[model samples]
Target: MNGNRFGRLFQVTTYGESHGEAMGVTVSGCPAGLELSEEDIQGDLDRRKPGQSMITTSRGEPDEVTINSGVQDGYTTGTPIGMVIQNKDARSGKYEPYVTAPRPSHGDFTYSAKFGTRNWGGGGRSSARETVNWVAAGAIAKKILATQDIEVKAHVNQIGDIEAPEVTWEEILEHSEENEVRCAHPETAEEMRDRIDEYQKEGDSIGGSIYFEARGVPRGLGAPRFDSFSARLGQAMMSVPAATSFEFGLGKEARQWTGKDRNEDWEFDENGDPTPVGNKHGGIQGGITTGQPIYGEVTLHAPTSIPKKQTTVDWETGEEKEIQVVGRHDPVLPPRGVPVVESMLQLTILDYMLLAGRINPDRLDGQVGEYQTDYHPRSPDNMKE
Candidate 1:
């Protein structure tokens, strides 16, 4: 409950359960005068919503977003922006069987142990559905970042054992959304879709990783040590439900590399600015941004809820039971997770920009307490001079 909020300056607080009335969020610290509409947020929600394709859950929620407050004349008012997405297709009856038994590798047990009781309907606040609120808030952040020329994007790069070949930014923009798998490589996406179909038929699930990148982020947006750019980004990526691992440039692979091999040499750019020759550090050096692209991957474990029979104990009866998690659920995660990853990237970058004072928290125009010479008329006496 206390951890529902994220960020220091640009704060985002979410509420509601997965199967409850609706999921909502209050986004504070957004500067006034920025253009925002429900449509801007709905596009991202559409990508993350369930029932997107043959591989996703069958729940038919439209995931339409409604902006409840904090806008007038189509611009943010610098107040808390309230938005909500109602749960139209949540079926509580299917989850009743596992209410006491708890699902394997899920937060059901821990939530019960800590809260003494839980909603138990579609996993409540512990559900990945909560990310709907995240993607909503991230849409606003992305809009704000766009004003500063920052861009965030992601693609499903790995599905189970099948991995797509490395792709350029242009390829991701063009091909990532052309298929169901959200992989940038078309052939690899087909293979990934087939693999997901195999798992769905078997009533099992698979895991994969998403590659995300942020470009046009200014340098010196983060601090050293605990507040490093990479540190905050890691926290953002790891917070995604089912995410098991996170890595940046070189990442774990850096273990096999010597200091000399991993090190990136610096040189002066044509504009006379210092720049790294290579991006082995993923655009960060000494925990701060270096004006290069920030790129990384987040690995999500297989979705735990599956129709395949799994054993668990019924806490209410104090007896063992075999449970088949019969319900609409995704056979794999990365396809739906691509947008979530991009959202997190945008949110993290915007928060850091606000913290670094690179962006004015009061307004997007960055003109605070300054005279509006263009709007104000000079006195008649002064005009004679």
Candidate 2:
């Protein structure tokens, strides 16, 4: 498709379909010589890969990545980085019945209408399966951001009606991975897991919001008008399949407060640098970073594929019919989408960093002194040069 690419300087063009032989991405504009390997990309793929847990789709694909180009000696070559993952588990037969019927609240009908044809198998190009490319590219972006001390993280904030409490960054890093749902709070994550189990049993699906947080982001990362930081983030997030809602900073809740309550008072940090006492703005002000942690949320709708029978009109027959979407699908999307959200955030922020000139594209061209080996990418220690 013409729109398969994302970003300008650091562009990623994805190809292949859900049921195709493979899906992969070509990431261009990455600077050369930063340490990279298939394993770096595989870690994020493992998180987004399906069939990982009972709550996700049963489609079993290791989502193993092969770096066919753009690297030499475990470092990038600054050319287009090519990577692929085989669609080993696609069952095209399961979707044959819906080829003409189309699924509700999905791209099936729209894609058919637009293209005069569609890949009915696993929703083809429209499937979340396509997101593997984004995650793979994002893994590289994460490595780039790591050099500049930027860290992106995301967690399931809401699952159906279960909402998590506001948590510190430390808490998120500490407890988010402790449970299947990836909610930061242990108790709430358990509740979410139980609820997902309930939905799995009912053959229904659930949806919820994911909170994205980026720490150590440098200021002035976005252009003033068209390339506003939040706007870019919104576009990246909304491009996600089934993403229905987006909120930045205080988000919807900010509407309830007056100017006095919403304003962040200017103060000084330990270094005597001016900073905001509170971050109601969620980091970006006037389309640029405020040197504060960027926080936002994306809300995804329940998956379109479900065991519950749905009534749809067959395009060829022009007759109404009930169809059961029998295929591997997530009962709840937020948990599985956490990595996707984080990946999108990484790509967005990394692109803006490139655009804003906060980082040099040639920073990774050689032996770089900015690299930190001991601290994890998300650690506060990594934030310090």
Candidate 3:
């Protein structure tokens, strides 16, 4: 009921449930004249839609997004952007058991404890299905960022220990849609898919990792001191329900290195470009973008529902019993999560770009570097080649 909103200047409030009649969002504060339509949002929706592969949930939602407002003649009017996705595959008959008893690793118990009620059908509001709004709102943000030459990408990096080969962001994007798992390496994605299949056959699930990168963003896209860009990213990721673990540039691996090995040293080029020799701090330092690609990773736990029956206590009687959540659920969430991660990146970077004045398509100043936000913390000494 509360806490469904995200963003500052470009805010969004998602409404609806996993089995609700309809789910949608109201996005406010976006600029006018941007090209937009249901078709624009539908492209990313198709990527995040369920029942795509053996690794995803069986629900066959086309996840088609319908634009209800904020656009006329394919351009935004600068008003609230409202869109909705109709629910056509909900089956509430499977939720009878959860009426009084709650499933483990779900919001059933917590919701009842806090609000005196909960929607146990397919986890009600706790379902990852809630991400539909994110993709919708982010689709707009991405369109805005593209004008500034900024690009955000995300891909499955590790699935049940099947790690992808190290590659550039371009390589990652090239390979992202090539495989069903959205990993850049074909061999690794094959192995990952095999592992997911193996677990699905056993009526179980597993966790995996996702990596995202933001490029071409002018420097000074973050607040220093407290509101570091990295912290904002963490907050965005922690919002995902099944997400259990995370790390960024070098993540916990940094713990294994000394200060000298961890510090990103700068090199100066003939053109005064700053080239970083290391990425020990992920991408942010002291709460600011260092004109380097922002790198981040999110770890997602396996879907909580399994066909296998489990034992639990009945809420009304406090008596022991067996219960199995029969909701249509994904075996593993990595493939579907790929688009979700990238969309959030668009939202995150778009906010900073707005603050840094890089998002204005008009370029009213007549040039890119003529604005106040154009100044990044770059010095001749710190310039790297």
Best by TM-score: 1
Can you tell me which runs of candidate 2 are displaced by over 4 Å?
A: 363-385
Which ranges of candidate 3 are over 4 A from the true structure? Answer: 269-275, 361-385
Tens-digit lDDT track for model 1 on 1-385? 5889889899999998989999999999999778889999999999999998999999898999999999876888789999999999888998988888889999999999999999999999999999999999999999999988998889999999999999999999899889989999999999999999999899899999999988999888888999998899899999999999999888899999999988888899999998999999988889999999999899999999998988999989999988888888999999999999998888899999999888999877548965333222452444665
The regions of model 1 sitting more than 4 angstroms off are 370-385
Q: Kindly list the per-residue Cα lDDT of model 3 for residues 160-224, writing each as its tens digit.
A: 87888787887887888998889888888889989999998988888888888888766677886
CA-lDDT, candidates in order: 0.91, 0.88, 0.80
Q: Could you give the candidate ranking by TM-score, starting with the highest?
A: 1, 2, 3
Per-model C-alpha RMSD: 3.8, 5.8, 8.3
Q: Which candidate should be chosen as best, given lDDT against the real structure? A: 1
Clashing pairs in 1: none
Candidate 2: tens digits of C-alpha lDDT, residues 1-385: 5889999889999998999999989999898767789999999999989988989888889999999998876767678899999989888998888888878888888898889997778888998899999999999999999988999888999999999999989988988888889899999998999998998899998889999899999877886788898888999999998899899898999889999888878988998999888888999999989999999899999887889988999979999988888878889888889999999999998888887776677556434556534323533576677
Report how far residue 97 has shifted in candidate 3, in Å.
0.3
- Model 3, residue 369: distance off in Å is 22
Between candidates 1 and 3, the one scoring higher on lDDT is 1
